[model samples]
Target: MTKPDNPNKTRFGFETRMIHAGAAPEPVTGARQTPIYQNTSYVFHDADHAASLFNLQSFGFIYSRLANPTVAVLEERLASLENGRGATCCASGHAAQILTFFAFMEPGDEFVASNKLYGGSLTQFGKTFKKFDWHAHLVDTDDLAAVRAAITPKCKALFVESLANPGGVVSDLEPLAEIAHQAGLVFIVDNTLATPYLCQPFDWGADLIVHSTTKFLSGNGTSMGGAVIDSGTFDWGQNDKFGGLTAPEPAYHGLTFYETFGDLAFTTLSHMVGLRDLGATMAPMNAFQTLLGIETLSLRMERHCANAQDVAEFLAGHELVAWVSYAGLESDPYHGRAQKYLGGRAGSVFTFGVNGVTGGYEMGMRVVESCELFSHLANVGDARSLILHPASTIHRQLTDEQRDTAGAGPDVVRLSIGLETLDDLLADLDQALHRAAAEGDKAAE
Candidate 1:
């Protein structure tokens, strides 16, 4: 076991941070890799120490639900990669959203969100949020005027995705952040699709970021995890908007998070309060797996982007194809935004459509079923190719207008490009599309 030189003070490049940030050699055995602290509880040295840990006066492993050492390493590593002050890991992407909202919202408050987002997120915001009397105003985030108009006195946050999921629109972050700031609302960007490898939303004025680590962060799709990272620049105490952070926490004997934790107030409260009670905590083993995935993120993303470009190009010229919606394409409407925020790559997951409404739907399904290499699954950001018709699967809960507005129309098929060789991947699409076209031809009779 080799002792790593000071993980806390270590400063390196993005790639280096992805691999070594927050990762220290094991104190007991000097293990080079982060060890999974799978135990449920940690021993408190004395009565004073226990009180200190419980009161948030000191930071140490208290319980698995509150925080685990292995998960803490992952949280720190991801926060460093994204240039955030700190981060908290959650059980799933949806949990991250809920926990983040818990920091700035109470019953009856509303927030503006992008209409075009992952299907699961739309459901979470549209349906689940209603249960708590919280509301989500889903609008076109691309429309600056609409976003500005949507904000109300009760609005607490502006939420949008940096690189949208199936829609693949590269959101205009700079202006939207300004709008949120002007209205005294927190700006939260879901950096799931682009990951930290592609886009850093905080640099574009976003105050906080959320990610579905289950997707790209765990590049291999081996673990289920999510994260909420705070830029630590949002002055929660600057205004009366964030009572949850600036006010005394009843759970912690009136400790105001912003007064005590300062820049890290959001993440600290999320861990001590939200995660403690909600219990949507990431497992130590999953965190360890996500750490392993982060180690190869840059490499995987480079290949994933290149492969996606190739796939998108191949589909665009196909006779059966109608339109493609990846920002990586030079002709894409979002190309400029992608260049500005995503550093020239539109990201891996994108949507495309075939010709007809009824016929196109059949062809899209056939192509998905015919694919021998690309899997027909709901997940994205895997090292392997994936295909799904979002209209019937992920977006089945929404109405026709909602589905169409979200770019999940009946004729559309979403693709999550992977790291497979260019030739083999192209051949797979060719076969799938051909089979799909043949099926359509037979149906015409």
Candidate 2:
């Protein structure tokens, strides 16, 4: 195994870290790649070692649910990529959200989130989270005043997507983070769409960053995983709100996580308490696959962004398209923000409205159905292009107002541009749009 010289001491570049961070030559065979340790349990050194592991007195793998060698490597790499102090890997993105909230929020506490979020996240926060007495106030983040107004004494955090899904809505992170910090609330940014390749949330003052590795992080769409990376700068002991971290725990014989783990308190709590009790552990195999996927993330994202820009430009000029919501476009509302945060590369996943004689829903559906190249599915960030009518699919459960607010209206057709030949992708979309327009014309008559 060729390893980076002084991996721990040297500050390697992002590309180097992606391949070598949190990894070393296999002790037994000197393997170059990270091996999937698919065991459920690990052997304890002795009786005292077992006790220490159980008591949270020391850090060692006791159960797969709490921690695993494969998942640990994934977590460390993600933290390094995000420039975070630590990270915890879980089964899915939703699991990462739950683990994050579980650490700081008690029952009846609340958080504020941008109205523009993933449809599943909207459902999770607005509906399912209510069942647990954890409330989320969805507000338009563009209205900074509205965001501040939404926060109250019970608000524990402020959440926003760095680059919102379905639509390419670029958030102004610096201000939002300022708002959260000024109010003594944790600022959580979901960087799923932009990925660390395009935007690093921690650099913009985000205290915690979340990702559904199911998307860009696992570019091939083969692995399902999520991660919550902690900046490890939040002062959990600064206020009484984070009792879960600062206060003594009954489960661990009164170990205060903030005191014991310091900057890594959130990450430790996620593994020790959240995963241990919630049982949303990331499979070792999934972790291994995701790690492999991340190896080519920079390459994939560069291609993804470049291809999406071309597609978006083509659609903006096409007769069958109404409007394109890609921040890469110069006319986009979020263009300046994208330039500031994403270095002018506004990710691959974005939405556009299809022009129809009768209605947009029908035309959008037709376009999606007629697409020969883009896969018709709910997923985004695949190596292959994907298409979906979010109003009828992902956001079908939400009200009309919720759908529109989330940028997934009846007129919207979301596209996840892939790393395909630009000419081929454009040709596919041109045919799909014309076919859909003709279908709509026939229906109108």
Candidate 3:
């Protein structure tokens, strides 16, 4: 085990922390990597110890469903990556979103959310979330007035994607965070597309940062997982907005989380109550895979960004392409915001129009079909390139106006650039575009 000089002091770089942070050599066998504790239950030293753990007096593994050493390390690793006080791993990104809201909202309480979100998230909020009486007011997050208007007395949180899905639009986070704070709302950002390697939402005033680790964090696309990072900066005890964290609980013998756990209150509460009741815990095996993936996060993201920029540039000037939506491109509408918040390299996932919104939609489908290097699928952030026609697949549930408003126009093609050589990826796209153009000409003839 490599003990840090101090918990409060961070001396190592991000890449170094990705591999060794929250990990220790196995005491018994000197295992260098985090070993998966696949058991369902852990043995307590005695009844006193069990009571101590159950009462939240001390931290120890009680059940695999709530906490596991392997999973804990993954959580800690994620927390380290985000420079957060803590993080909780869950079954999926969708589960993370629900659990996050559960921390602050009761039934009938509402939250404000960005309209430009993953299709799954939009459906989860617009459709499924209503079942819980947890309402969401969706608006264009970029519109400051709309965002301010969305907040009401019942608004408990503000949610948005750090790097929006489909369109790859970068959310202007600082001002939004200020808006959320002025209203006493928890600012939650989905950092799935950007990952911690690209952007740390906490640094920009986000109280909570969420991730779909199934994407870039797993790097190889072998696992499905989600993570919720707590910045440990939000003061739940300040008001009734986060009563679940501030109030004494019937669930845990009237122990208040904010009082008991201090900065780590939200994370502790989510682990003990949210995972226990909701049963959306991430498995030990998946956690291990995600940990492995994060070790190379910095490296893979560099390549992903480089390849995506090249592809975006090529498509911007292509005769068959009408426009590109990558923030890395100088011509992109989001380039300014990207430069201000996301550093110079605007992540790997982006969208482009093959022809025009009308003709492009048809070409988008054919191009997706014709692509050889890029896998035509719904998931993004894999080491292998991926392509998805959101208008037909992910965003099919949304109406035409909704889809277009969210930047998933019928002609838009979302690409998750990978670690493949730039030449190979561009060549694949070139061939696919030519094939799609030929089919279009034949149909026109």
Candidate 4:
């Protein structure tokens, strides 16, 4: 039987694509939603067909460890939303990072990444990646000179968060992309914070985009998934550094991915090699949940940003607040970059320092514990508002200097604004601030 052509082949707006892209009524059951293909393995038509699937000559699922129908829809939808040629979905955002670098780096390879990133990412690059003999040079990406100086011959890529988590620091993407291309390094952006609804990193010359779809893309805190999308513009054959793509693969009967797959080489290699070996495939049920979440991404993001702006502004003026670092505010250092890259929406997740009589750590904890409206949790991008004290929780492994630089300092409280009534959010925060202050005063006495 011949494959049926996609009805959604025509280009559409992001909002439309979010709902309709990569999906058609189930061929057999006429289901409108992408149904979960929960089985572990697929039977091939014949030995010839099985050989083709195993050899990567055809794109079909052989095992759940590599691909699934439900996850494929999520990958396609993400690729459409990001305006990229292809995407690969995995178990979580961290898995997405591992898959992306696995495609490029061999042993003894190096990469440069922005120092300001999710605390987990910093630890992954600086610590876990070292286990693979892959070294990372963490640098202040804001300083172009420093970034240039950090890139040596062994460096394979440059990584940065499009909007640094918790810090509200918006990266200057265009110049950073230029710098990466000049140094012949692949540019990778973690777009978890600034979802495609707010900023499309591919629009600014990014070669690759990664997302912890567990966050904004999933939106409701119900699913865990990650994705890596390829722009399909990088020239793997330009140099032999990326042997995984350009060189022959002994496992697949001397298949040269770049020569055979062309624009899809990296994405194909990611599935055939990365997912096949690493086994970080996303579950079909999780993909279905995420697809449902993504359907209303634009709507949720607009409300999230608006609520965050109001909350940030309210905190900026609160007597017990030391500082707020949301780029939506004009006084923020990265306000200009936010305007250029994120359409002036500085995302909903940001940090503010709590002013305390003794120390920020104590006051910050009090404020978090005092909030009634916001749920105190480690996760973000929920339909409900969430809060965290990063220094004690997410950034606990980092040293004092590291936490401060990443904007997850002792006094910092990170807020993930949700679709709550603006007045209620304000009142809740206001009460929390005063309550914390009162408690701090009693402690002093």
Query: Evaluated with lDDT, which candidate comes out highest?
Result: 2
Per-residue C-alpha lDDT of model 1 across residues 1-445, encoded as one tens digit per residue: 1123223224578999988999989989999999988888999999999999999989898899989999999999988998888999999999999999988888999999999988889999999999988899999988899999999889999999999889998889999999999999999999999999899888788888999999999988799999999988888876888999999988788899999999878999999998998899999999999999999999999999988998999989988789999898889999999988988987889999876434767777888999999999989999999999998899999989989888898888999999988899999988888788777778786
TM value for model 2? 0.97
All candidates' TM-scores?
A: 0.97, 0.97, 0.97, 0.97
**Model 4: per-residue Cα lDDT over 76-117, one tens digit each:** 999889888889999999999999999979989999999999
Q: Which stretches of candidate 3 lie over 4 Å from their true place?
A: 1-9, 356-358
Candidate 2 runs further than 4 Å off:
1-10
Model 4 stretches with alpha carbons more than 4 Å out: 1-10
Please write out the lDDT profile of model 3 over residues 338-395, one tens digit for every residue: 8777777899998888873337778889999999989999899999999989999999
Estimate the lDDT of model 2.
Answer: 0.92
- lDDT of candidates 1 onward, in order: 0.90, 0.92, 0.89, 0.91
* Preferred candidate (TM-score higher): 2 or 3: 2
Pick the winner on lDDT between candidates 2 and 4: 2
Better of 1 and 3 by lDDT: 1
RMSD of each: 3.9, 3.4, 3.0, 3.9
Give the RMSD in angstroms, all C-alphas superposed, for model 4: 3.9
Clashes of each: 0, 0, 2, 0
